[model samples]
Target chain A: MPSPLRDLREQIIRAASVAGEGHIASAFSILDILWVLYHGILRHDPGNPSDPARDRFVLSKGHASLGIYGILAQRGFFPMDELKTFASSSGRLGGHPDSRKVPGVEASTGSLGHGMPMAAGMALGLKIRESASRVVCIVGDGECNEGAVWEAALLAAHHKLGNFTCVVDFNHSGDRALMLGDLAGKFRSFGWEVTEIDGHDHAQIEAVLKPHGGDVPRAVIANTIKGRGCTDMENNPAWHHKAPKADELEAVLAQLT
Target chain B: MRRQFVTTMERQLDEDPRTVILLGDIGVFAFRNAFKKHPKRIINIGILEQATVSVAAGLAKEGFIPLFHSIAPFVVERAFEQIKVDFGYQALGGHFVTVGGSYDYAALGCSHHCPGDVGLMQAVPGMQIIVPGHPAEFDALMTQTFASGKPAYHRLSERSNREARCVTFGKAEVVQSGGGPVIVTVGPFLDRVIEAAGGSDATILYYTTLAPFDAETLRQHAGDGRILCVEPFYEGTLAASITSALRGKRIALSSMGVPRKFLTDYGHASYHDAACGLMATDIRARLDELSHV
Candidate 1:
């Protein structure tokens, strides 16, 4: 079997190849968080899709959908073979995750600034049901431009949803590398207990998540490298979604080796 | 009406823990005392309309019935994505109570006027649009909406009006039956149409159920003559429904309320008949013209 990290990288490539468009940098940046959540931390069952107690995860940064799609394919939510349908007209996958179309997808998301409140809602539901399950979300640092995100951030704390955790994939870059500014501190202003971390370190993510309970809603600002783990494409905007022509693909593949 | 809505919900919550009530800063209205009564169940979700409906959808997937309420335009227009994706895509049972069926905020002008809610909301699948005519219909619709157990948008008036006699959820309410002209009224504006027609002089068809309409009632009431419809807002409301169901079987179904084009007009009339289009005078004049044929 391919290593989980390696499998994720290939899935990202495959998903982009199928759709022919993607936020490649953001997708790669959140790869480790997606890996650690699905493989090591979150409790879920691939076999039974509707288990009430399963920990829920919302890819709130839905532009980076390939990460979640890649993990779902690996977990056998559908089949690994179905990745071929990603973002095609006849496909179950779209540019973002649509829960109605895909099994094991907790909620439909593509509209950024909208998913976290739904995540908070899911967390609220778990609490109302008196279940021990938690709700987790992966959001993008740049997507904080939306006013709705702050509303949700304030709501998450106001509700006292300690069972909910948000991980912000902070690539320190934007469509133009300028935004509303100071995203990690912005989370603090919204009353989130914030932590900044190295997103590429799987061990750091694993070590930080060992504790289950907390009093406040937590935010992990995972400082990541856009186009991470790639050699020449590491910070190149051209590779954001451009299909690496044969030579570049080979070069990218060689770095993984 | 808010009391009726929340009390009915309270009854449902007592039976099933999954029933939830979400208000978008709509506490000044009544019956949602349930929020204070049961803190876990009733949530004043503040003014964020977009997040409110998305969160409702999330709560619904967890097997809860979410009753969402707010001003007409903000609740429906602001959170359209949430409504379309969360509720419409999934067809979850959500009771969306949107106040201000028409120009209730006469002075608030364009932003507050929800001329497009019913028509827009009606286009969504499994979404039942309700324009209850009076307090009685409001109470009945509240009970029936829960019993129907489906996604619905109920547009209620901010002020109470002359109470209509009867209200059936999916069944059409036949107000004043007569042979010449049939006035199909939506929301509390039905009272104006009934009054304008000089009591039992003309037939009035009050629509408490905007969609999944009692086509049989429309077919029976709307035969071989002009049927006048009075509503608070635009052509999108019940006009499309009547058009779709009846289909080219023209009985001269002219809508009474709201301008067909962009209404740059302002001010809330105690009733919107002639000013907004659904006045009995307009209906009477139209019937006169249609009777010529």
Candidate 2:
């Protein structure tokens, strides 16, 4: 694992430990995808977060807010020290990303199936203004169960939002409740250019994150393990919402290294 | 009224570059000319009410003033959480202009009816609810409030009052003043309320804007502490505002509108209105009963 990615995992673990609450497994699933987007793909500035021409990224699956917050902190949108206040009343960072409070967050999304449509709208707005900016929204496989997710898929396709991309974190977290079978095929049928990739692979993530020149929107199915780094937590539903205690934190950090 | 909405939107589109119209496949024909003029601005977004609202929120986030149009139930009731969360929680400004207010689509069954839209929107903090009684009033209210940088719900109805009063946002017009009980009416109910309170000493307050509830006007005109709200939506939609407006004072409040229950009996809006006792005679009797009290 890359040193920075390893450090980010440690930061997420410690912050969730301090807060005593977070969807740690969910965060781990999308950490690398978020890291690649913020570091390489998204045209954003921590200094001027509200740049009119900046590409918008909406984490539609907001339970993984810890992942985005850690990346944003590392990216200098805010100081890394703020991570200690994660999910605390005094902190701007909550369990779910709030756009109003957070600098880099484009949409305040906690509810599943909202971010993609919002991203489509942003893409549509940019297209109307003849701007070069793009919008990327990430949704969980569980979020696909929401009718609004498919509704947004149909809308983005109908509008021919070529600038919009929806990344699905296919961590199989939703498989226990209702299996989202054939997600890529579903996006293809909905008129989106579908790309399936290993979410943890930074090279694979960076390759598909760019603007694909076409009228149809794009959907990236990012196949990821629930907890990619830690051995005990990997693909474990029990770790979905659990934060490590002091002893468990030592073991999780060891696994990350 | 939908025609007036189209006309107003056309004028808005021509005047303002930021104005975007998102239709939910309902009023596509009406916006044909507008679509021709501003092809990109006027989008006939498919019948996905939830996604459409979030899309409008997205547009708002991008600093464009988006106006989403659809039926009352689909836009306001069905996609209410989108309006509440996407716009209200985000503090993003957009407009939701809905036709088929209350039982306006009464014959289409309960699925199409949204008598609870105003009430539902009222629950969303900072949401501006406008129930225009006339086409001209719709134009005036939409013109004034659409770009106010706040989430607003504009409920348009097929029924219009005989006359159009000069309406302002958040300010209720005193149609007639009396020393008797205050009779509050909103949207098209103004004419019916007026007719009901005919030859009586009841003060009629017409509300084109429901939210930011014109409590000042209500407080000033609410003499003898007897208030009767005759709304076009669910009964007591404005109860909180009324009571909150005159909190300390002892006020006798009664309301008449579409019952909170579903109307399983399919019929025209007029038939539903009559069934729900929303006619002038019923309103007059209610007024008389309040007067006696």
Candidate 3:
């Protein structure tokens, strides 16, 4: 495992430990994609987070907030010290991301199936204004159960919002309830240009994050494990919402790399 | 009123560059000329009401004023969560102009009926509810609120009052004031309320905006603490605001509007009005009873 990626996982674990509550496995599932997005893909300035020409990214699956918080902090959107205040009443970082309180957060989202449609709307608005700004929305594979997700898919396709991109974190977390079979085919049938990739690969993620220059929107289905690096947490439903207790913290940290 | 809405919105599209209209596969022909002139601004965005609202919120976030047009039930009831979360929670400003509220689509049965829109919207914090009684009033309210930077619901109806009263955003207009039970009418129910209180010395207050309820106006003219509220939508919709406005005073409040139940029978709006006891004669009887009390 790469040292930087392992370090990020450690940061996520420590933050969750301090908060004593978080969707740790869920955060682990999308950490690489978020890291790649903030590092290379999204054209956002940490200092000027509300730049008119900056690209917009909406975390439709906002329960994995620890992942984005770590990335944003690493990118200097806020100080790294704020991570300790996660889920505390005194902190701006809640279990879900709030755009108003956080500098780089574009949309406030916690309830599933909201961010994609909002991203489609932002993409449509940018297209109308003839601006170069783009919008990227990430949704959990489990979140696809919502009717609003498909509604947004249809809308983005119908409007031919070329500036929009939807990334699905296919961690198979939702398989226990309902299986989303053939996601790429479903997106293609909905008129989106579909691409499937290993979500943990930084190079693979970076390649598909650029403009495709098409009339229709793009969908990247990112295949990922629920907890990628940690042995005890990987694809473990028990770890889905659990933070490490003080006694178990050392053992979990040892498994990160 | 829908015609006036089209003309008024057409003029707005021409005058304001930031104005945008998103239709839910309804009122496309009415906006044909405006679409030709500003095709990018005027869009029939299909029948997906939930997506339309989120899309409007997105546009609002980008500094563009977006108006979503559709039937009341589809716009307000079906896409309510989107309006609540996307617009209200996000603090984004947009406009929702809906038709066929109450029993306006009475012939279409329960599937198309939405009497709980105002009640539903009132639950959302910072939501502005506007029920226009006349075409001119619709035009007036739409002009003032389209760019006000708040989520405003402009509910239009097929019915209209005989004359246009002086309309304000949050303030109520006093149509007739006398030393009698205060009769407050909302939107197009003004004329019927007036007829119900004819030959009596009753105070009539007309309300267009229901969210920032004109409690001050009601408090000023709530004579003898006897108040009768006649609304075109659900009954007792204004009960909380009325009671809250005059909390300390002893008051007898009676409400007459659409009953909170499904009207299974298929008929026009007038027939439904009669079924709900909203006709002038019915209201007059209620007014008389209130006066005697």
Candidate 4:
């Protein structure tokens, strides 16, 4: 039997190939974390995507949208056939995810640094409304370069919103890899419960994301490789925005198998 | 104007449970009673403007109508991209209430002076911009804005001493009528325009809302084809909108507002208004010039 991770990678490759180009490597890096979230942690119903009591998931690092699209479809949020229309002129699946266009998407995020602030706001709102639901935001390590992310980080801690959780996909890619030294330390100083873990490990990812009943927002520093499953694409900066060509795609898929 | 905003927001909080007020650590004590009454809804997210606006966007997404408040520059200029993407692009509705229009805080220098706030918001598509002339107008527009369920920006100046007038949303109030020239006063600029007109024959069109602009009213009152626009923000912010409203009409138009340059001369709002030709006397002279043209 094919592993769900392998199946998700195939789905992403198929969609990205049709779209001509995508952040395949970026999507692959966050695949496991997203899988564990939708399958285990997140209290969301595919039938009722707009369930007020359900937990909210915002993919702040929206460049890795394929991972989310794959998971949502697999979990029956929408038809898997919709993935073929990814990045098409009239398709709902654009390069970045839009909440209004897609089901199971809590916030429309493509611009870096907006998701955490939005998630913080959602958490604050949930707290105000006395709802037990939580808000989880997935941000890229590169995306943390934005000052808005830090501003949101400070706000979440200041409010002591325990319902808010930020998962940083610390793949150490791009110029931000060199600039964002000691990422966990930065989040710790911002007053977050920092837990550095091997991102590809599903058990560890699920462990941190589950509620721990603290008076502070939690930051899970999921240390990951840029392209986790594929050997050729792993740690290759060129795969940040570039899709794998025919031969490379075959090679990557073979590795996944 | 800010007091009326707080009063209106307090009422909104009581009426609607979904209404949440988020502040950027500005006006901490101003909303003391509100904080005391509704502790859960009113949130002071420290001095983070970017997060403040983004959080409002997020709350709006989560079925909560969040009314965010801060100084004009911090709310509009500082976190403008958040407004552009989080609210505008995402199609989320949030009420952005900003104080200190133009040189309201002249003593604090250019940082507090947000002369370009309206222009900045105007640049983003789908943002309903409202500038109330009085407390009553503020109340009416605030009610209408929350009810509208659309993304909006309300620019509040420091002065609210003018008599409260019955103002409608998306409709201009014809204060004084004539045929010489149409003197359009935006928000708090009404008192100054009224003073400038001084029983003149020019038609006075006072508008509290700018985005869903009442073009039909402007056409009805602008019979002489001569119009003078007096605004409290950056010059020519509404020129494009006015031009679009009166398209294909042969008319003489002139605008009076704060110039694009920041005025280093520190004083009251009136001082900056005078220096930038945004005061009543300056408006009167411009109206005279427009009438002749």
Candidate 5:
């Protein structure tokens, strides 16, 4: 069932491995979600990142920089070769996503708890302007501790914004520790239709990609590992930040390939 | 001050469709008419001050100039992170108009009335702080801030300050003229310094912009005399930023504002102003004491 897109998870990890750079594990966790959005879901023209009709994908949990950058490259939004500059200076890739620098990025978000509200605002802006472009806000389960997340969730649901969909990368670890891991119930409490699924399973992710039962904004809680792909990095919080040694890179790429 | 900001916001909404004004369940009176003129442009996000700020940040992210109006203590204090993360990190077009700067709601109790609203938010990257001295300065500052495509905090005092010479952005008003002593004042509370220093040998100036105030401008007006500062809001940053600019000069500096702790004991208007030494006589005594030291 795994295809060329499935293989991209290995390629992205390989790029970061080559440079010994990036939050590799965090990126590895949300690969399927990004893959589905870029390849199948998003209505975009790669030539125009600012194309008004294009749907937006906000990396609210922006620390997972590797996942988004890899998707952009694989989708031809940028040169696949450019991904070698993952976390290096002079590279467009920041430790967090920078919308101003990154072509396909909608907004810059590295600080926790900010991404969703802006996404909700964009969704509302599109509604007021009568644009049909949908907005996908990728949030971290742990990052949900921010009270603004709930506030935005309420706004989205109350407005019955079906054009907006939020996917929580329920990787069980924020920068420090596990955030509220119960995604479905939390979203339920905040009045969102919740869907729980395996994050890495492409079929599982695609099945739930449809709009919610009603006009309420939906939150898909994708259960994922922190560092998912490489054997050495899986579930390892030590790999939360980048410091992959050269030999370590060779080893990771070998296993991934 | 609140009415002027609201009126100007309504004017901008008519002038530019890109402008959106959000009130945090506090300033409904100001935007009631705007709802009729531009219903889509105005939002009343009830009671949730933090959400109100982030919602504005969202609107700003999409190239809309959003004016976030709320009382000083609640707007800045409660929603500090939303301001920092949403607008500060991303560099959005959100203007936080904090009405009621100093002891505006002295009678409303402790949670509402303590100074330091602007200082708490000033150091955040990309956030510019503005404190309007009088009604005239309020309009000028509001127009200039909206024109600039950046994040700003316009700190407006609640009291109907005694009208002085009109002030422009970044220009402090020299209320009382004297060479021996110069007391730099900010916000609408300059009325106190005018009363205290009017008959004395002291010069009083109402400083306009708290953030980008050309320190060189303040330094020029601050030499060969005792430089006493009257900050009706938090003393830490406003007074510190000015005094820091005057370092190594022979100008002796003294600062007065509400102490860090929230003062609990409720009192009459005179008691609140004098106790914090926002009153001109209290300021005079501090200057008199500093001279002895």
Candidate 6:
């Protein structure tokens, strides 16, 4: 049997192929983090997705929605068969996740830099209510170009939201050259507890994601390759939004297996 | 009006534990007491308009009634996408409190002027747009909006009318009884429209809310079809709604508002109003011509 990560990758590829289009590479980069959180770290019940006590996960890098959809379906938030109908008008899912349409989607986010502030607000609300629930947000390295991200960062730190955690997918696959120097230092300056990890290393991902009750927020810079599983597509910018053809898909599936 | 806003917010904070006020570092002094009384609830999220709105959406999702406040330009225009996706797309319930309507801070230049906020917000589906006419109206609308448990935008202005009526959402208040062309006043422009009428038999209808426009009420009042709409924002912001409301009727309509042209001259808001023919005199002149036609 394949590892959980391999199985998720296979599901992601099958969905992308069926949809005929998706941000497969972008989804692949964040797969391990999503896997670890959904499988181990997040305090959630698949039977009760809207439980008040459950931890919240926001996919701030929403273009890579396939990654989230796979995890949600795999974790039993919905049926796995629904993945085949992704990006179809008949299907509930769209190119970007819509919270109203999809089960377990906390917020509708396709436009970059929106999810961080939302997660911060959720964390603040949870803190106000004195609930043990935590909020985990995943944003793309490319998506940090937005000014709102920093605004939320400042707010989270200023408010001392220890219940909030942000994970940046440092895949270096933005349309432009990745010029963000010392990402960890920048987060530290904003007063976040910054940590660096090998994104695909399940152990490292889990270690950083473990919730620590502290005054400052946490930021985990997960160093990853864009098309993580398949070597030919790894760190390849061209694969950002392009779906693989049948032959390529078969090869990718074989490699994952 | 600012005082009334603070008072009502304090009451809300005391009454409703779910009420939270998020500001973009704009109303630090104006809302001091409310902030002091409820430090955690009345949050000054620095100068981040985008985060301010997105955070409100999050708060709304968590069953908190958040009132995100800022200047009209920054609150309505800057974080518009978040307003659309985070609030409207998620169907989250919250209130967006915006001051500096149109050219309230005209001397401060274009950045402060927000004549396009109403029109921009109208583009977002399911947003209730309210432009209160006075302190009394502001007090009532703010209370109702919070209690309504829905997404709303309360566009406040520095200007106020002498006459105060019981204001409600999606309903027009008939300020004066008359028999000639119907003059529809929105926001604080009710005072000017009353002045423009100037003893004319023209009926006056004032509105605090622009969305869910009381078209049936408009039709009942403006049966003659001669209507002049005086709004505080961009010209004809309410035209489409009015036209839709009074459709199938032979209506002779003329709209008076801030022109679409960018005003380079920096002066009082009244100066811009005068330049754009939004004041009472210009409104009277337009009404006279509409009467002739």
Better of 3 and 4 by TM-score: 3
Give lDDT tens digits, candidate 4, residues B1-293: 77778888888888898888988788778889989999988988678788788899888877899888889898888899999999998878889898887889998998888888888888888889999878888889888778576889998878863698888888988999987898777887888889999867899988888988889998777785788888888878889888888888987778888888877988777677667877678788888887778
Give each prediction's DockQ, rounded to 2 decimals: 0.65, 0.90, 0.80, 0.80, 0.59, 0.84
Docking quality tier of candidate 6? high
**In candidate 5, what are the lDDT values of residues B1-293, reduced to their tens digit?**
76787778878888987787777777787577888878777877666777677667767766688887778888888888778777777788778887656667777678877476777777687677777767667788888778687888888776757674576666766666666677777776677777766567777767777776668767777757477777776665566676677887765777777777787766665677767666667777876776564
- Model 4 agreement with the true structure over A75-168: per-residue lDDT tens digits: 9999998998999998999889998889998888887888889999889888877789999999998898988899998888988989999999
Task: Say which prediction, candidate 1 or candidate 4, comes out ahead on DockQ.
Answer: 4
True contacts kept of each: 0.74, 0.93, 0.72, 0.85, 0.56, 0.89
Candidate 2, residues B110-214: lDDT per residue as tens digits?
898888899899889999999999999999988888779999999999899999999999999999999999998998989989889999999999998989899
For TM-score, candidate 2 versus 5, the one ahead is 2
lDDT per residue as tens, model 3, B21-69:
9999889998889989999999989988887888888888888999999
Error of 4 at A109 (Å): 0.8
Residue B291 displacement in candidate 3 (angstroms): 1.5
DockQ-derived CAPRI band for the predicted complex in model 2? high
Scanning candidate 5 chain B in windows of ten residues, the lowest lDDT window is B234-243
**Residue pairs with backbone atoms closer than 3 Å in model 3 (clashes):** none
* TM-scores vs. true structure, each candidate: 0.90, 0.98, 0.98, 0.96, 0.90, 0.97
Worst lDDT run of 10 residues, candidate 5 chain A, spans A248-257
* Model 4 error, position B263 (Å): 0.8
Candidate 3: regions farther than 4 A off: none
i-RMS for every candidate (Å) is 1.2, 0.6, 0.9, 1.0, 1.7, 0.7
- Candidate 5 per-residue lDDT, tens place, A177-254, comes to 644646689789888888889998888887787544456788999999877766777888788877566666666665
Any residue pairs clashing in model 5, and if so which?
B116-B234
10 residues in a row with least lDDT, candidate 4 chain B? B270-279
